[model samples]
Target chain A: MLERVRIVLVNTSLPANIGAAARAMKTMGLAQMVLVAPKIFPSPEADTLSSGATDILAQARVVSSLDEAIAGCRLVIGTSARSRHIPWPLLNPRAAAAQAWAELPVGEVALVFGREDRGLTNDELHKCHYHVHIPTNPDFSSLNLAAAVQVLAYEMRMRSLEDDQVEAPFWGVDWDIDAAPAEDIERLFVHLEQVLVKVDFLDPENPRQLMTRLRRLFLRSRLDTVELNVLRGFLTAIEKSSKQ
Target chain B: MLERVRIVLVNTSLPANIGAAARAMKTMGLAQMVLVAPKIFPSPEADTLSSGATDILAQARVVSSLDEAIAGCRLVIGTSARSRHIPWPLLNPRAAAAQAWAELPVGEVALVFGREDRGLTNDELHKCHYHVHIPTNPDFSSLNLAAAVQVLAYEMRMRSLEDDQVEAPFWGVDWDIDAAPAEDIERLFVHLEQVLVKVDFLDPENPRQLMTRLRRLFLRSRLDTVELNVLRGFLTAIEKSSKQ
Candidate 1:
């Protein structure tokens, strides 16, 4: 599914950014890259910055125009830094990823990135089916070219991973021990209160919400069986020491 | 709220990457940056790469140690590349952002990134209450420092925007107590260990990750100041009972 999505860079000035973009894309499982009228390509600076992702740069397709880059793409999403008055559909990175995945089943999708200084031309943005804007600080909205690529690629990977999952797995359940059952938790609380009273931490006559607060905290954590047993063991040890 | 969340970079080698990281943070509306023992600073390379985000570089706090960097932060999240044997709570960038936001009402929260070459050390990772891992391609998983910052910072921005759009806030700051600071949590651990040994529940010579498991459970709960005091009082009570 990720292979069907191609990253398109239009009129990029720095070859190093292109190399870095390739590295960014590859890190997020994106393979295809299309370069449209970059100022410099096949430069050592790019290869040097690419680190180990030279394979992405090696297979990158260089084209002369934006039309060539998005020729075969069924879904074209252009990254826009500024709000254009065209009133086209605008999506965040995550939403854009979802839209891309939805379109990927039928045909190819292109995530187009514009030049460093200025983003995609008005005409270029018009060609896009959706304009995706990374919500940036209004004052300092200029995002680095590769940084932008990294954010979009990351969203793509996250969306893909979410789709791959059978269901939303509950956290803390994957640990070695099972989550303590309600009965176990109730027993632990009962034992805990007994020890607290014996150790003079809580007065049985007036507990004053101390036990309630503790219960709330522990309940939110959803202690596992091992944690519950550990607590019970500690309580027993405390009880014995107090008696001694 | 965003200002209360900091981006901490430890032992960064290149000044250029630091500058790029500053730019990435500023673009996403995050202002605070703590650099722990970078190799070089105030470099022209970093400034050049930062483009227009020199203010962030100028204001970034350069600390000697990771502890100093995250001194007052209540929530410390480390970026980990590998899946360790220990079953620690791991979150993706989106979930991490949500967690950071949830904790922001109490006090400062930190997002720690490690050295450029090796990433965060095991010891450094253990210090984090939670570990956030970027879902990168396993085959090409190494992301550039600035790129990683970009992804996390972007998520932060997205989360911030989502909250702003909602009519009512997700969580209110009108609570009676703030979350316990990091120093308080540390003190609790120290006191916990002492009582655990005194009661013979934990053999000091063979602790065997017992304290670590306890810390994980408690930290996930984000105990407030009142809860911390109550727990400390209980620990002191246990110690007194054991001596008697």
Candidate 2:
């Protein structure tokens, strides 16, 4: 996943900021940097600002345009401080990373950052499928170019590190055991509803509101198979007691 | 909350970075700046780099030691890339901000960032009650001192802006209505144990084991008054049933 991420800087003004961006990217485990018509590349100022991240700049790919920069990438995310006039699906940095991670196949995923002064032009922004906005103070939303890259890269790296398999510990056992699948849980809900109606705990007529509320409560609990069985057992006991 | 945050730079080498730090703080609504053993103060480079934030530097306090800088602050958060031997409570930026917001008084909340090369010494880290480690790439963790300050300041500002009175809504109306005062909650736990014994859920003989498990479960739930009332009511019902 890390290898697939390609960070592209578009028309960067300051060489120092470009260097800092590379440093930021490297710090967050992101190596691939593509500069689009930087004002001054391979400058001493850039090397000085990059500190230990000179290797990233040494290996960086230089391009002319945004289109040329992200040509091969399957997933393209444009970074923006403010919303544009044209409609584009907007996502926060974390959500954008999640979207990118989900969609990224064998192809590269390009995370495009705009210029230091006036961000990406609408034409450049239009080329990307989604725009990511870092939430900031309304009064002073001036995030440095490198800081912007750092935030996005950090989110992507953190998400990548999360375990793919969803397993939680419960009662000194992995909750995956005896876990009723989703279909089973849905079937049990139907069964419980039938029993509730028979017991008159749920009104058969005009039951929509009450049933919805009950469903929401159960959904919020996120019960696995063992927990579902425990709940069903309790409901069964209640049903028997009602009959008695 | 913003007023309470004191931004402390320890052994800062560059005057320009100090200026940048001031600008970053001001942008994030953090006012106080404390410098500890800086190489140069009142340097022209600092004023030049400060941009429009020179006022923050002008008002900044210079202290002889890190200890002196944070003497008044109850919550001291040290920022570092590396982990320390003393094992101060390690927190991510958000968690550290939450802890600071909750624990620190309205007077001073110290956020300490170390030198550019080697970060805070183990002894310096020990002085802080909590350590905030910005999630950076392990391979190259060389974040600019000012950038590090900016990230933490931004997080703190964003968190502080969230509606202070609004309890997380998931806890529901019962939480709002029948919520126990902190003192009442503590008392209720003691009373609950006494009732547990009467109900024989707590064994009169060989009591420690069952009581420990029950206590653990109750603590995990963090029962408010509404929850406490529900449990107590159920226990009363059981006692009545036993009597019958």
Candidate 3:
């Protein structure tokens, strides 16, 4: 699966970034490198930055245009740090990799990275089937090109590992299971919020920040279906008692 | 919860990384910063690297030892890129943050990062209740300390955001609902291990890494009480069958 994915650096200016990209990709078990009109390649700076991953550079395909690089690819994803006004089915790196992995065809899958100064042009991005934005700090979203490649490659590798066969625990009368469903958990949160409001623990007028905090606390729990039900039942009992 | 978490850097050599760490923590809504035996402080380098997060550095606590920094912390999580013997209850960053947020008492929660070169000594790590190993590329796991801090801070902040009340989908439920105690899960692991040993799945004479792998797999699942009970029952049944 990693072999099928090619990292395409389009119009990259820095040879060091190109080398770093190779090193990052190689670190994450990705070897295919496509350099599209880089300012300098086969330079000492690139080789030095690549660390021990010179093999990736040696085998890299240097193309003239993004179209030529992704010509044979079945799945195309453009890496962008910023969101676009023209939404093109944006997926986070993890989801995008999952989607690409699930829908991979016979041809190569291209991950296009743009030049350092500016990201991919709208026209070039439009050629992609999906856009993947790595969640970064909103204020300073200047992720190095190599870092971006590293994140995508890492996510793809993790998704691939998850695809390997792992037996799910058996579910039946034989095993006594007591876990809540997702809906019940969602309901519990609603009930809890009301209780907080009733007790004045949650200020109704200035409630945005408090409520957001509460949501985060529960989401971190990643409460399974059964756990949700149990929590909801507890909340229901509490609400009933408070009515008295 | 974010208030309780103190990001501690021990024997930090670079002032720039310290500044970067401050920026990362601030972005993630984590305010507490502790510098343990740093080579330098209030350096212009740190100020420059901190960007707009100089306030975090202004309020930073300087300590002499890892122990003093985390004296009041009920839950101490140490970060390392490498694996160690007697693994201190390993967790990924998200899971560790969740656990720390849920379990920590009304005191400091230390997240100790080690020196740039050697990392935390085993003795220093022993003080932690759990070790958080960020899954980086195994071949080149040399992540900048500040970068590592950024990843952790981001996860903690993201989780904290979800806990906010107003935006929570399940805001009505009381978050104080009883959770199956952590001790119960720990005991269950012991019981399950005993059963595995009895069933020859875990061999005492020539243990070939089976138990370690099993422990890692189960620990990764982050099994709650209900899931633990289900596994325990299965193990009990296997034991009864063997006796018969």
Report the number of the highest-DockQ candidate.
Answer: 1
Candidates ranked by DockQ, best first? Answer: 1, 2, 3
Listed in order, the DockQ scores are 0.13, 0.07, 0.03
CA shift of A177, model 2, Å: 46
lDDT tens readout by residue for model 1, A85-196: 5455667888888877765765678999999998898767755666788888999987999999999999999989994533223444345565565456667778998888
Worst 10 residues of 1 chain A by lDDT: A165-174
Regions of candidate 3 where Cα sits further than 4 Å from its true position: A13-16, A42-51, A104-107, A163-244, B1-5, B19-32, B40-61, B101-108, B157-244
TM-score of chain B of each: 0.66, 0.65, 0.65
Kept native contacts, as fractions per model, are 0.34, 0.17, 0.03
Residue B95 in model 1: lDDT: 82
A-chain TM-score per prediction?
Answer: 0.70, 0.66, 0.66
lDDT of 1 at B71: 70
- iRMS of every model, one decimal? 19.7, 23.6, 19.5
Candidate 1 vs candidate 2: the DockQ winner is 1
CA-lDDT, candidates in order: 0.81, 0.71, 0.69
Residue A11 C-alpha lDDT in model 1: 95
lDDT tens digits by residue: candidate 2, A156-235: 87677656322221121133444233344455678788788878878787775565555545533435567788888887
For residues B54-165, what per-residue lDDT tens digits would candidate 1 score against the true structure? 9989999999988788776656779998587454567788888887876676557889999989999866765566678999999999899999999989888888889443
